[model samples]
Target: MTALTTREQIVTTADRLFYENGYEHTSFADIAAAVNISRGNFYYHFKAKDEILTAVIAARLAHTKTMIEGWEREAPNPEARIRRFMHMMIANRAAIKRYGCPVGTLVTEMAKLDHVAREDANKLFGLFRAWLGTQFRALGCGADADRLAMHLLARSQGVATLANAFGDDRFIRREVALMEEWLTAAVAHATPRPDNRRRQH
Candidate 1:
């Protein structure tokens, strides 16, 4: 295989180290070693581990946004669109099972030490929540759209954290199931119950 370019090597190595270890535990030395570059050469591309981490965070954010957008496009209706969003999260069960949402993980771990990192993390969460708010409104989710949007975001991240910490599939399955149930309730509650719609005897 063609060797990965230096920048790609650095990013790939950083991604793995940061995900497996953490932003705080990972260091410049680890990155240099992982990329097979000396410290001097590594410094040529990145001044500090923070710079590399910023790049890694940016890349992950872009990747996530693109994935969520693609899922949105594939959705056929408001409810499916919402369920698809949840399923898209379910698809990440493996990653969640391993590393958790990188942005959420990093923010919790490094937010105090790194303002820039925290800002980037906030951007990722804000984008998802905003997109969800717009989607819920589009689906006529009424006054509860905002709350429900926040709830969905919280539940997704919370489950990912639990999965990562506990190393259990039950967290992933149960959380996604709860999200699906909530989506159904939200949709039903948003719409007026028609008198013509009769209940089963």
Candidate 2:
């Protein structure tokens, strides 16, 4: 594999550090050291912490778009595609229990800091919302697609936050199962049933 460039390395390292430790808690020196580069070299690449943050967010956006595309290719069925997103919690439960979710934590930290990149961080959520909305639309949700997408995003974040707080694997598993059932119900309700004009109540 081709090695990541210096700037890419710095941004990648900062992304991990910022997720592991809140943005404000992690310092320039920390990221520099983590990347095994001097502060001067780090500054040469990322002049300010926020600059690094912007790069990291951009990288995340690109990576997420690519992932969503892969999901599209891998699961042509919208419901199955949506399940892949939902099942991430169960698949990454260990990390969720430890870190609360890389996206959620970063977004929350940015909000609390009133950081300039808060909206940029939010666009991460926006990506999921829009993609899931498309998937819902494919499932024939029509006008309710975006709302259903947001609902799923909200539900997953809530589960991630509480799962982190409680570190309960069982709760994570149960919530995932419930979310799956919820998706099935939503799809069922969204679809138009065949006419039952002749059937008795």
Candidate 3:
């Protein structure tokens, strides 16, 4: 693979730092030190910390979109796709235990700081909400799709918060299994829309 440019490296490092250290707490100097670059070179790439934050948010948005798209392509059906989303907790259990969900913590910190990029950071959650809603709709949830989407998001957020507090991998595993079981029951109860039923017939 090709190497990331200096600007890309700055944004990536900033993203990790922002997640590990709150946006309000992390300074440009911190990033520069982590990247082992001079202030002059850092300013050449990002004139201010806000610019770095904007770049980080944009990069995260693009990465999240790509991930959801990949799930859509690889999963055989909507239920499987949703399962993949739920399984993310188990997949990133270590990180969740240490730092909490990256998106959740970032958004929470941004909100607390009253940061300018709070809305921009929140778009990450919006992307997942929309994608999950689509999967629920496909499963014949119809008007309830958005509600179910939010419910799943809230559940995951709660699990991440508790997991981080407790640092329990077993908790993550149990929650993931519970979520999978919930999805299976939800799918069984979801009546196919008229058009979908006709198509199957």
Instruction: Report lDDT (Cα) of residue 12, candidate 2.
Output: 91
In model 1, pairs of residues that clash are none
At residue 148, give the lDDT of candidate 2: 94
**lDDT for each residue of candidate 1 in 1-201, tens digit (9 for 90 to 100):** 233478778987898888879878888988888878888878878898778878888877788788766756666555776787787657777887888877687777767675667777688778878878777876677676788889988888888878888988876887788888878877776763222322222
lDDT of 3 by residue, 71-163 (tens): 877786788889999988988899999999999999998899898899999999999999899889888998999999999999999999999
Stretches > 4 Å off in candidate 2: 1-4, 192-201
TM-score of 1: 0.83
Q: Pick by lDDT: which candidate is best? A: 3
Go through the candidates in order and give each one's C-alpha lDDT. Answer: 0.76, 0.88, 0.90
Model 2, 51-148: lDDT tens per residue?
Answer: 98999999999999988887777774788889999888898999899899889999999899998999999999999999999888878898999999
Specify the poorest-scoring 10-residue window by lDDT in model 2: 192-201
Provide the RMSD of all predictions against the true structure, rounded to 1 decimal.
Answer: 6.8, 6.9, 3.8
Provide the lDDT at 29 for model 2.
Answer: 92
For model 2, what is the C-alpha lDDT against the true structure?
A: 0.88
Q: Please give the ranking of all candidate structures by TM-score, highest first, separated by commas.
A: 3, 2, 1
If ranked by lDDT, best first, what sequence of candidates would result? Answer: 3, 2, 1
| Best-performing candidate as measured by TM-score | 3
Local distance difference test, candidate 1: 0.76
TM-score of each: 0.83, 0.91, 0.93
